[model samples]
Target: MMLLDSIGSVFSVIALKPIIMLMFFVIFLASIGKSIGVRRMYVNMLVRIFEYGRQNIESVRKLQYSNLNSSDVDEVALTTKELSTDSIDQSSNSAKINNVTKLNGVVTQMVNGDTNNGNSVISRVESLILLPGVENCPSKNRDSNQQDEIETLEFNLSNCLDYVKSGMEAIIEDEVTSRFEAEELKNWNLLTRTNRHYEFISLRLTVIWVIGFFIRYVILMPCRVFICFVGVVNCVVGFAIVGLIPNKKLRIMANDYVFKHTFRIFCRSLSAVIRFHSREYKPKNCGFCVANHTTPIDVAILSTDHSYSLIGQRHGGFLGILQRALARASPHIWFERAEAKDRMAVARRLKEHVSDPTNPPILIFPEGTCINNTSVMQFKKGSFEVGGVIYPVAIKYDARFGDAFWNSSRFSMLQYLYMMMTSWAIVCDVWYLPPMTRNEDESAIDFANRVKSVIAKQGGLVDLVWDGQLKRMKPKKEWKEKQQEEFTKRLKGE
Candidate 1:
């Protein structure tokens, strides 16, 4: 009976009680208060945080504090004030280098979200992310599988466009300024917004949390105590139910359930003012799945439709730590793009995950990275090699969702969501085309182009499609498949 009562207390605490948590918070604040001038600093900090994203994001609701905080955001309207950086001042030196330099090496660092000192920032800013195989990448060749020597394409500009633009004003100095504006305009396809939305939502979340805590501690705790009293009485009368059998899987499942339900309801409720058609993909099983990286939310957008194991790039610090937890509980694989040694190992690990039965299909962004969602970039080979039956999909958000593009710059997720509501409705047509198989002779680029064609045809926006030799080969995949089957039959002497 005593044990049952004690166990009951824990359940009571979890359900509605908040006294324990409140007491903890009080003690925490009291301790912090003792620091010299801490209270003043803290209050000011909180107020400034609230003021940060006042007008930036469309709807600020979720309280993701760890990723970004209030003062960290600039809520003032994003002005036409040109993005000032130290690198542009140094670009004169950058342009002088006429020899072939590996730009991706620099861009990859930026893509990995790592800033290389202050100088490389300008050179590393990549507005466009090529699909995996469209360009010759070292990541694939690391594997034992032999790859034919291939050439990669440069930026889609005819000349240098790096120039100084002052206050929404074009300060053109020859061809350099034209290229610079074009570069900005190109990436502008992926709408850019200030991070004020995050600030707004963080403040909201702080408010909700405080109210919920107070209600739990003041009202719910007393109620739970009464329930525990009942549990005590029942113990003498019958077999007292004791502690719950700790089930990690069940806990993980419950967390995911609440997490998802909360996200949906949150989005739907918030969507009352915002304009996104928010939903999840309902999957019958868990396994590896891949999509073209149009926007970074391709995973979240798809996951909304179905709950599946997600594979994504790794982040360090708090973001990475949470990811590590999620990855451990669910199916997730991380690839270090910078690790020359571990790159192949990463691919192998992905292959293993794809082969797992319990894992919701492993997902990959064949484009490897993202650009403006106008067209699909060259597909990476990773998906085609392991994901034999390539599920080609093209996600097209409304033009209003323009600011929703994922790029190298740091974008607050909440701010982007808010933009969707005010500026546009988020909509994407996820076409489940027939799966594909690999061939012995065909290159990865060929497969990517074939899939790209399928996506482009469905979206009705291939007019400016970048055609390469891979797409030029008529019936390339079909021809390759026929030859493969014939070769197999001949080998079997059938």
Candidate 2:
């Protein structure tokens, strides 16, 4: 009994020591805003492994294809021989037709016995043959007019076909639906998110996958969970302390400090590697900082570098706890669902927030919903209408590392966080663009679009005009009506 007790005690000490040490190490790094290149080294090693796996997979695939090609070659030769025979037969038929045409000058003339009659016969035959790129030469003015009418009908039909093709494409892969899903990676990163089933491709890959699974689930997840717990506790405690301070200026300063450091700790929990560019244009006091939304983590990602007052609909559960914690320390605006839907009230709150210079810049994702990192969708005009200096920030994630988009409808916050913790790392680049303000003549919607275009251009993302809210609701009736109007115009040759 004594030996067992001693052994268990030793094992607990060995396990707890490293965990405690890692907690301190992470906290220290977060406080200093420094990285020791551990994540970079891990990423470099992963790159090498991915490259090695890709090369081996290619070699195996080539060997497989080569074997297939050997059998395919004989089948292809046989098919080619048969095709040649059919082509010869077709050529002979054409030759016979050409000979008859030369003898009679026109094939229809041989059957009709008069040139005028042959013209009518040819027209009738052409009407029966509805082949593309085939045209009948008309001898009379009336026949020519009829031919022109037929061509006009075809042109109109082709215009409608264009709409059909686009509709089909949308049905298969619509912009809104795709934006709500994970962005596809060009290469497999040894993650099971891909449809390639790359793990089973080779024995080496299988072994690597098993090892990676152990590292991600057994080693990294527990550490990340522990760090996340520490971060939350620190945030709650830090905010509670900050709330106790009575002096406004000192409280603001304390709040900013606590927010930035707490978020940095949260960032480290996910092993996030964020690179900020053009820091000179970061959001200032009493300004509206607009960004493209990809995930709920965007707040943490941005807060790691600069503190901003968040504005959004009040959420519940884990998100609610964090929201309440943040609200206690700062002047964050959280609207109930009913209040959020009142644009005038929401704008009023925003205007009040920005009017106060003491408040931090109000961080707003005018998109209102998360989009896959591939594109910037339509920006709501409410924030732009609030009349404040807009600081546009563009955030682009490296999906090769891990996808950061949050599909709230499909996965809950906890599920999304689990996936994030297990991912290799959240690597992204953030660009802070110059400050923008609405032009005197520019409407709020136009100003919003202008800002969105700038962010999309900076981030190398597609600029789209579709509302992000389409993820939850169907497109507005006005949009469908506009499309119908355009289709009618096209049909009328306008």
After superposition on all C-alphas, the RMSD of every candidate to the true structure, in Å, is 19.4, 13.2
Best by TM-score: 2
As a TM-score, model 1 comes out at 0.42
Give the worst 10-residue stretch by lDDT in candidate 1: 179-188
Q: Which 10 residues in a row give candidate 2 its minimum summed lDDT? A: 125-134
lDDT of 1 by residue, 167-237 (tens): 11212222111211111221111122422122223455456435534644555344334432332232222
Reference-based lDDT, each prediction: 0.42, 0.80
On the 0 to 100 scale, the lDDT of residue 154 in model 2 is 31
Off by over 4 Å in 2: 77-159, 338-341
Among these predicted structures, which one has the highest lDDT? 2
